[model samples]
Target: MAFHRIFVLDLAGVGMGEAPDANRFQSVGADTIGHVAQQWPGDLSLPTLQRLGFGNIRITNPIPGIPPVEQPTGYFGRLHMAAQDNRRATGLREMWDYTGPIRTESVFTTLTAAGYSVTLAGPFLSYLATQTPAERFQVGTNQAAFQILYDRLNAPVSGLTYVVLPEFRFAGEQQDLEASAQALQMTDQHLAQVIHDLGANDLLILTATHAADQTFGPTPTREYLPLLVYSPSRQAGHALGIRRTLADVGATVLENYGVAPATTGHSLLNELTQ
Candidate 1:
């Protein structure tokens, strides 16, 4: 069950609920997915996510349409931001355990050093350009980003591919609940294709850097982001629980490649592989 390829999909602004320290940020009761589902005209169809344990996350806090299933195909969990604020840059850095003003090393660099090909796509490409030695592809929209990622997944290669979809973030910023819900549906459809195209050795991690709950305001909200891990080799899905930091993601990736993790978070590789 060793994974030769890992795909990290950052569905920006897709938060599940408020974080433990939401009050300090004046973001109590902020639930990106919940709000979008409630305000959305009808039950949001997310068959792909449901099969991946998206509904299981609602066992603690409910999302309108997604409900807990008897068995999920992947691991489900939520992650808390380790940074003081919910900034995009801070969240991304925390994923690799970077806390300094200037990041010297990251998951991308660590993977590259281990001889893994790292490819990054989406709007964050320029922001992360100087951090890692990766094959970067800048895309304009979420659709374009996912298309590029789909194309890469279909290629005959095994490595790490990271893509960030900003449409949700943009919709959240604009405070358009309808747009946000629509984008979620569209993303879910695209996710079905992505899952269908995944190879046996491919590992897919879906998460968010920060929550831009339109109901809260234009700024990012302090909220718990969704975490979904899927691989064809896994027999059944289980709850990963609340991760203290997003760095666990990087740790898991490094562990899969036999590279030691240089982060504060523990690796979930064992849990997923066991």
Candidate 2:
């Protein structure tokens, strides 16, 4: 499970499907991914994510300009949140399998506490990234943050590293889905930039802490989340079509280090080549 390096990009609130129990949260009609694309007033395209199996997640309406690919280049699937409350901290904890309420720890705390050398970027993880970088790129537009990350990718770093983006959340909150689509495009374009710079020995994980509710429609939106893994190591075409939880992600990260996650989760290491 030990990898030479692992990079996690948390695209905050880029939701895919509706949560099964969205009715109570007043978001039963939530489908941030779908809603954003549907209401987007302009052409939309995320060819990078589409190539990674994003389009395959939906059967009926694919995101605005994103269509399902004939064959995906990486592992693709959906993650269901274990808790009813959907917030950043809650989702981050769940990524590492913390289902208990009133918890104050996360995968970051656990991994670093265990003596893993780590470098972090973005606002959410600046607390840790600050341990190294002089200026943390935690606050800014998606374009701004990504510009920094694009450069950081070329710099040498060991152990676990992370990059967080709140722009999606910011854009998602915009009254205009067109604005949200623009943010999505900007992020994807940057993602493509950094992804190409990744080395063959590296593992890149793309996920969202949770989906959003930008559109408070009379109809509920989907609460499903997207998980895309980009690695030259993994063969293409296989899909990890199953229901997983955010905590499972934390567990998987731990698993990569040959450590067991406190919460229940199947290691995705083998699935990389599935």
Candidate 3:
């Protein structure tokens, strides 16, 4: 059977549980989509990567460093502080692209190779502020954007689509467990809408790259991560245990569509489809 479409919702840096009473945070490399694809179940991850059809695209990874870069040696060195602040305002995309390592393949590219059309969607902070200028002082979440994205995704596209929604991007500096839960709810609600619109015959997969209780070191660092999967095409269960590595996502997807992933990962597709 030829799988027609696929949709993925990727919420960046959405840590697991509640925020900790700590100072800094760490961003483990495995949490990114690329790493997740590497661990897909079976050997499907490899051939799939070759079929991605993205061409020779050079995607940049993000990096983080200070004191070493521009030590306050002189006036210009002091100005680096302001430069760092500007970097923060640009949003996490650049951060991940510049400082983050290329540990895994792109999730978007992998899915495309698997023969499923995909569409990644997300909201950047600066863009959100611009959209709702009046709500500059007020905190913003992906609730509204999630609704719009879900509606669009479920609106009967010509083929399968992958949509990534970084709910964490909407949560600004407010790092709280409630924020994480709210982000999940926001994701579920939009997904529910899509499922309702598409019906049970269509496939639905839900998962997270990693979880964060708080920052590790005021910058990104290697840390523990978790992954979740919910597919109507699979089993009907609520509140399943978390997967340690995000790579399992690829394996599970391949199994669901009857195509083996090219990489190695835990394939919970059996449980999900069970």
Candidate 4:
């Protein structure tokens, strides 16, 4: 089977363990944990995704951070880390067994080709980097940026299914987990409003890229992130379990739609759908 719509969200600076429901939303992956984790997802629009075969894509209020510098590479190395996200781990000239757009693009592209209409939306790294003067904040100093990103995704266009995504991992860094939880609660309210505006019975999948371990004291440690699968179609409330890897998002989405589960990550559909 195929899902009529799909959504992929990449959040910002989400560490491996942090926050009230730290397990509910954290980003993991050498790429995410090492590099992209510090940045927000890109501001790719629906038109871009459609051109890339997705029906729609939106990257909302991405975090702020500087991208790594690029370096010259030898023949094979150049072919390896050419993709923006991959360049951080593989470096200038070195090939891993798998070299491709291992970020969100890889998963979305695969689903698109499989006949699933896709939408990508999220805040971008450059946008987020601009938030602070400490360097690497690209999200402009305009409060409107966040509101606009959310507003623009009000509904799905023809031939495309709409998905509003927000990764709230960085919230823990603002003060303490309490403040972070409040922020997440606010974000959840906003997202809930968006969903309601889009119409009742719309499918929703909320996830944390990985986890973080931030404390206001003299200690920190890695922890598991949380994943929530909410489908009005089924009246499902919440599903619990630490997604072991970032690729788990892809796998769960495929399973949700009845498509052959993509060859990545673990599947939580059984727990989520049943």
Candidate 5:
């Protein structure tokens, strides 16, 4: 099941939620995709991500410029983080199925150990923040930084290319709604290049680390995170019919390389194998 390459882009601090414990976290009104769109006159337009089945994910609220496709090119869905803490570390660890105490290894660590060249960029926080890889670049704390690197690379990138985009929630926390929306748009542009240059066997993953707040509409509400996966050589499947949690991310990544999954989550990639 080993693939030639896997790239995971973390859109930090974005959420589309109905979190299981939203009420308790005072985030019951959070909707990263919807709230941002509400600011603009029309839905946020992202034709690039749209073609990748970004809009195909099932949700009560959909993002602008990405309405569900009649037929999607990749696996699409949303995932709840499965906890109320909602910290960046917590969400990232969930992807690795790290259930605490035993201190499980991360997907990044595992991949690096298995000899995959891993590169991390931008201000996107990492649960395995301590692990240095074969190569690394500092993209600072902005969305545009990542885009700059993406353009420089221009050609198809190999290895586990993990890039973290700026957190819209940071701007949202300052109640600078416009700035947050602009940041989201910037990431969309970066993604367009990614979708355009994907190699035949490369795997692409675009997801939020956690649902960070964007004013909560001057009040409070629940939280939700977005999840998406694309493979240029996908063998099967379309929209994910069932709800998914972040744990599935780790499972799917491991499964792609024929590694055994943790006892926790199941692989959504199962639907895409030829």
Candidate 6:
């Protein structure tokens, strides 16, 4: 199914569990979602994510309230950070395959060259917009960011929209489980609207740049990030398994628009569509 629009929601610092090399970074047993769920005073409801296969990523050890459903409406998976450090900048760079100091090439550039209008919205746009050719909307809050995305989706041009939500990250940094739970609820509500507004040719991806498990301390934890994919055109949802690198995301988007990836990652488009 060829999508006319693609939306990548970067839920920054929303990690699932510790990565393979978690001990090397002194972040062993760091699970952002797990800790948040366990400590959330009451039931932490995230119906939208649950329906999108959020709970399917971890079968053996599932999130408290968001258990794996029998039939999810989207694809679920995990992604390992390819960069040595778990910094947001490095994660974003790796996603677009930006390796050089002077970042000129990326998935955004490739999409632009392919005649796809790309819009980037988030509080941390400066970290990425300066390096890419996509239109930038530096929003201070998630509401404003989603508004820009909604506007872009209504626009006539076929394009890609990237949004970053830092609520979870902020809450995690503060080690506030209540705040984290609230952020999840609020974001899930917003996501519900996005899901409802999605066109048949629209694809939505929810992921995180790195893990910021509050249980692991104030610094970013080395952990596996969640990958959730949904499209109105998809017939059924399935597990996408664990992706090796974040670059696979860029590769999938480029392939969707008939563009070759300029980075070092395989595309999951085939698995997504087939």
List, residue by residue over 1-274, the lDDT tens digit for candidate 2. Answer: 4466688788877788677777767676677888778776665778887888888877575766688888888677877777767665666656644432455445665666666655556655524443442234465566666665666567665456666686776666564566667877877787787778877767887888767757763222337788887777667846666556776676667777754444565667766763
Clashes of each: 0, 23, 58, 47, 9, 0
CA lDDT of each prediction against the hidden true structure: 0.84, 0.68, 0.35, 0.33, 0.65, 0.84
Candidate 3 structure quality by residue, lDDT tens digits, 98-162: 21134544333444465544444444434323322112122234665465456545666533333
Q: Against the correct fold, how does model 4 do in TM-score?
A: 0.47
- Kindly give the stretch of ten consecutive residues in candidate 3 with the minimal lDDT sum: 73-82
Off by over 4 Å in 5: 58-60, 97-103, 124-128, 141-158, 167-169, 217-222, 235-237, 242-244
Model 6 scores a C-alpha lDDT of 0.84
Better of 4 and 6 by lDDT: 6
Taking every candidate in turn, the Cα RMSD to the unseen true structure, in Å, is 2.2, 3.8, 17.5, 15.8, 3.4, 2.1
Kindly list the per-residue Cα lDDT of model 1 for residues 96-163, writing each as its tens digit: 65322354557787778777888888775557787567888877688899988988898867778989
TM-score of model 1 relative to the true fold? 0.94
TM value for model 5:
0.83
lDDT of 4 by residue, 1-274 (tens): 2223333222222332332332222222212222222332442122211222111111122222222112101000000112223211121111111123453333344445555544433334432222222112123222323354354346453112222223333333332444333334344445545444433334444434323333322122233223334443444233243443445555556566654535545655555442
User: Candidate 5, residues 93-201: lDDT per residue as tens digits?
Assistant: 6776544346666676666777766666656434445665635565656655566456534545445676766555457556666777787677777777766677777
Best by TM-score: 1
